[model samples]
Target: MTAVEYEENESKLMRKAKENPFVPAGILGCFAIVAYRLMKMKNRGDTKMSVHLIHMRVAAQGFVVGAMTLGVVYSMYKEYVLQPAAAQKALEQKTALEK
Candidate 1:
């Protein structure tokens, strides 16, 4: 490909990386708030069972949020970065064969 096309492709990939960037940050913020609230409840002499339930809920929420964030990041990275690299390699090989 031409130099201009290569630069444009790189710019597109960077844009994809920056797109929807706030989602993971928001997820992490929610997790932090939930954890802090849970800690505060425990510190205020809440019942053991209630504390345990709160802990469980916080853990569940954290796990779900973590999984979702990871999934989104991985999918975006794979789609924008890894897939393009692989496709470029394949195209190069195909062009080499044609020549």
Candidate 2:
């Protein structure tokens, strides 16, 4: 493609990306895929498993599990705890305004 056409297309892609709600999740998934591939390559055989490799894998697994757990907890808090509180506050404000 010509330079101008490429630039126009790139700009359109950027604008679309800016509006995409899943961009963060997509980026995180890409990073996780790359990290998993790299870890596999690093641990490829011929060299017997060492203490360091085991520790590294354990740490990585812990990090992934911890992050997932945190995300679930935060989402639950927002949905069950925060939403009800917010709704109650809004209702109180509406009632006060009507008084």
RMSD to the hidden true structure, all candidates? 8.9, 10.1
Off by over 4 Å in 1: 1-46
Per-candidate TM vs. native? Answer: 0.48, 0.49
- Relative to the unseen true structure, what is the C-alpha lDDT of residue 89 in candidate 2, on a scale of 0 to 100? 100
lDDT of 1 by residue, 1-99 (tens): 422233444665455435545455555666776777667775666468676667657775776677567768876997899989999999999999999
Candidate 2, RMSD to the unseen true structure: 10.1
What TM-score, to 2 decimals, does candidate 1 have?
Answer: 0.48
* lDDT by residue for model 2 (13-91), tens: 4653444424444446556755775567665657555754665566556655665566667668877999899999999
Alpha-carbon deviation at 51 in model 2, angstroms = 4.5
The local distance difference test score of each candidate is 0.67, 0.62
